[model samples]
Target: MHVPDGFIDAPTSLAAGAVAAAAVAVSLRGARRELDERTAPLAGLVAAFIFAVQMLNFPVAAGTSGHLLGGALAAILVGPYTGVLCVSVVLLMQGILFADGGLTALGVNITDMAVVTTVVSYAVFRGLVKVLPRRRRSVTVASFVAALVSVPAAAVAFTLIYAVGGTTDVSIGKVATAMVGVHVLIGIGEAAITGLTVGAVVAVRPDLVYGARDLRQRLKLRVNGELIDAPAPAAAPVAARTSRRALWISGLVTSLVLAGFVSFYASSSPDGLEKVAADQGIDKRTEKHASADSPLADYGVRDIADARLSGGLAGVIGVGATAVAGTGVFWAVRRRRTGDVSPTAVENV
Candidate 1:
């Protein structure tokens, strides 16, 4: 959920900001190991896809709606560290450009939505994949479960954060119950979307899926009275490598379609957090967003007047900006990884 300003006090918000900063810093370092030729390119696309899917909010309850959080989906497609960065990028873009999330509360949103969800879901996914049958289907199953659990986990995280710094005097127990209950329904939707997306990619090109790497069951060979692991095959030709350009183009097109047009049909009800906040009086002290005056504020272009066209253009712009920003960040991370290796080292190899 996108926490708005004044929901949390200054001290707690600043503390959360520190935590968010630290998490991002750690993720940047870890991403160096996760992003390579194949994954590096896909990482940006994954961020854009998440940004698009999040616009299509589905109805969860009478007055509450939910959308894809994208932590599990991103983690399954890319990696945990990169997944954090992806969701963070989307949150940052929404806060600064769309005025959806408050700028002052950026840290709170990033901590609850980006860091918590990615950490919890990826941990669950890794754990399940280890115990379950090592198959492509298993990866999808794990993704579904991981996403399902991550939504509520994020809700719990928010509840705790609110308990510590909530501006209102609402009952913490009631808030927790309401938040968790609605989010559980939201989690089901998250699970389905994450599972289907991860499944589709794994089926098409498992090699491109960071989490699916080394998923094949190692072969065993009978050797002189012993069963030994078979030798790995030689690397394929550069020409044989599937071009990610096609997948990237397809994903970008799908993102544009979803955000540009499909988003119009999304439910109009308040999202899980918004509904809960209104019900629990959490917004009693909520302040206006600093970016509320931006041309693209509230997901509409200024002076467009046409609801469809305004929102559509805004969505398209959001997708484009997020893609460009995310691609730039990931490319820098990838380049840094390359720069760490000296020319002599590459020549030696």
Candidate 2:
């Protein structure tokens, strides 16, 4: 949920900002360990896809809707550190370009949406992966469950932040109940989307899914009288033709179509956060975003009256901007890391 300005006091917001900054710093270093020449660009595509899918908010309750937080999905498809970067990039783009989240509240949004969700969901996912059957399906199952838990976890995080610096005198108990209750429903939608997307990718090329990377199923054969696990075959090097280019292209196309067109049919109701803010009087102290006057404010271009053309253009522009910004950041990180590891960087599958 995008937290607008003034929802939290300056002190708490600043503290959250510091926390967000630290998390991003840590992620930048950790990402180097996860991304190589091969997976670095895919991370950018993942960010753009998250930006696009977030536009298609699905109905969750009578008046509330929810969108893909994308933390678990990113962590499962990419890696946890890179997943944090993906959501952070999307948040930064939305705040500065789309005027969706407030610039002053950027830290609060990132800490709650990006950091909390990624850390919680990835931990849960890895824990489940460790216990569940090590199969491609199990990875998808873990993705779903992890996504389901992450949404409520973020809600709780926001509630705690609000309790610390809430501008209004609303009952904290009521707020917590309402926030957790609605988000639980929203988490179902998150789970479904995460599961389906992860399943599709794992089905196509399990190698591309980071969570399923270790799922190299072994062969079983009869040994004279009884069946036994066959000796594992030697790992074959990936051919030059085997790359993420096809998957990246497919993901980008899907993102374009969803944001450019399907988003038109998405529920117009306020999302979980907005609905809770309005209902719980959290919006009483809400301040306008600084970029409210931007041409692309409210996901529309200035003086473009055609709803379809203006909104679609904005969506396309958002996807493009996020893709470019994300790619540049990741490429630089990869290059620096490559330089450092040139003498030791291992690129084998």
Question: What lDDT does candidate 2 reach at residue 342?
Answer: 50
Instruction: Write candidate 1's Cα lDDT for 1-349 as tens digits.
Output: 8899999999999999999999999999999888876678789989999999999999999978999999988887889999999999999999999998888889999999999999999999999999998899999999999999999999999999999999999999999999999999999999999999999988887878877886866789999999988865555455536456777889999999999999999999999999999998899999999999999998999999999999889999999999999999999998897899875553332
Best by TM-score: 1
TM-score of 1: 0.93
- Candidate 1 lowest-lDDT run of ten: 233-242
Across 72-109, the per-residue lDDT of candidate 2 in tens digits comes to 99888889999999999999999999999888899999
lDDT of 2 at 26: 99
lDDT for residue 101 in candidate 1, whole number 0-100: 84
TM-scores of the candidates in the order shown: 0.93, 0.92
How big is the positional error of residue 94 in model 1, measured in Å on the Cα after superposition? 0.4
Q: What is the lDDT of every predicted structure here?
A: 0.91, 0.90
